[model samples]
Target: MKTADPPRPRTRPKRPGAPGAHRRRALPYLLIAPTMLALSAVLGYPLVKLVLLSFQDMTRKELFAGTDPPWVGFKQYRSIFTDAFFWEVVGRTALFTVVCVGLTMGVAMGVALLMRQVDPWVRVTMAGVLVAVWAMPIMVAAAVFRWLTDTDYGVVNWALGLLPGADFTGHNWFANPWHGFTVIVLVVVWGAVPFATITLHAALTQVPAELEEAARVDGARGWQLFRCVTFPVIKPAFVMVTALMAIWDFGVFNQIWLMRGGQPEKEYYLLGVYSFTESFAVNRYSSGAAIAVITVLLLLVGAVVYLRQLLRMGEVE
Candidate 1:
């Protein structure tokens, strides 16, 4: 009773705005402030300008005259949406992206599995070759593919001609859009495979051998092993790589442009090339901006999927 009469004053809670509390809460933001500032300066400004430009009817005339183009308020977008050729380009781009992504992931998974099964020296050699391929410049790779698929005296044509009933001599790969796209696909896949392979192989290394062994003990073999155990372990990596590959392939331009000698045919126009051709080649700058904006919106879907995968992985960890 005597001690209760002298009860201690109640302890005060720390204020949210206390100097130390505030600093602790702000430390992370403070650390990231420079990065955020740099990204805003570099990326944010251009994105805002692009959106603004898409709303305006900017042409070569306006660009040359250094005058601000009149705002047309979605006219450019409407024109693009209404164009049949735009839809064709979209469809073709989508088809190309699906094919490329499919082949890339398939071949990459196969190569990764091969690497895991091969002898140590063979695996090292394969990795070295992959690294070399991965480090190659896109320009150099495109130029090499161009030479290989050249209408005359190409090594590819020469090699194909060596087959008993096949004659690829003087074959114009780009004459038929289908044939052209095949070569382009090959080039794209060749350039893409190394990265995907290496990434998948790295992911494969993380797979628990014990799990695979246990699955094998239960009579899981080949596809069953992969589908049940291996694939699940690496699924996160596979999804991330596939989404990135789809996005990159969807915007393919340099390979097509360089292969077609700086003037890709309409049939060859993916969204990126279409946007560039519209802007600089035909002086439809605002229309190009609109197309670009649309392309970015489409790519945002993949980006969202990629982000979600990362978040899910983080939560799992």
Candidate 2:
């Protein structure tokens, strides 16, 4: 009887208030707030400014004195399309990226595979050399290459002198555009090889001994072992290395520019240097901004293509 009397006053439990629901919804915003703030401070502000600048046809005069920036929608974009220099820059950049990345990654993979048979200490020593090369600052490395490529007293030319009727020595690398381009590409390859080596070496370690043994057990030769077993496992690393190297090659301004002594020639005028000249040297803010936007778009497209290659091999296991 007593228990029945107590049960007569039963009521439904109360749900959380609107403020609690609001706080629950706000959790994601709270978590993302720092990232949003950081982006606004670092990337967001500059991007917004660049976009604003791109749409306008304002001169340096208009920019510096805080006047209302004049809008001339897509004039700069149209000009970029028409500019012969822009096309030259694009071509040079593209060529440099392709050659440097190809040479770097190819050699790196070959060397890594060769080293796989060597002792662990030798592998460590080789890795040390590559890491040493990588750790050297870009400017310092460029300077070393410049001296080694000197027209009058270069080691490369000296090495070339061993060949009869070869006048590769005393050739003006910076003076002749192709020579300059070649030397710059060589330096780029040299710089990028270490990254490829390190990445591929790490990847090669994860490749099972059993797989290679199985391939060999099937009467596979060196090439066959790589073709059937090794290559498939390291494909991801190869793609990633190539993409990053391509981006680095494209944005290579300091190396080529410094090597060529900032020459305004067919060979030295890659997109990065061109953009730099436009922005800082020529004081063409809008033009420079336009170049930057284009460069970013190119990089985005390249990255997408690179990532797609890796994604296409989905779930290799």
Instruction: Compute each candidate's TM-score over C-alphas.
Output: 0.90, 0.85
lDDT leader: 1
lDDT of 2 by residue, 32-97 (tens): 999999989999889888888888876778868989778889998999999987898898789878
TM-score of candidate 1 to 2 decimals:
0.90
Per-residue CA lDDT of model 1 for 1-317, tens digit only, reads 45556777998888998898999999999999999999999999999999999999987788889999998998898999999999999999999999999999999999999999999999999999999998888889889988988888689899999999998879999999999999999989999999999999999999999999999999999998899999988988999899989999999998898888899988889999999999999988889999999999999987998899889987986
Where does the lowest 10-residue lDDT sum fall in candidate 2? 1-10
Off by over 4 Å in 1: 1-25, 309-317
Return the number of clashes found in candidate 1.
0
Query: Measured by TM-score, how close is model 2 to the native structure?
Result: 0.85
List candidate 2 stretches off by more than 4 Å: 1-40, 262-266, 315-317
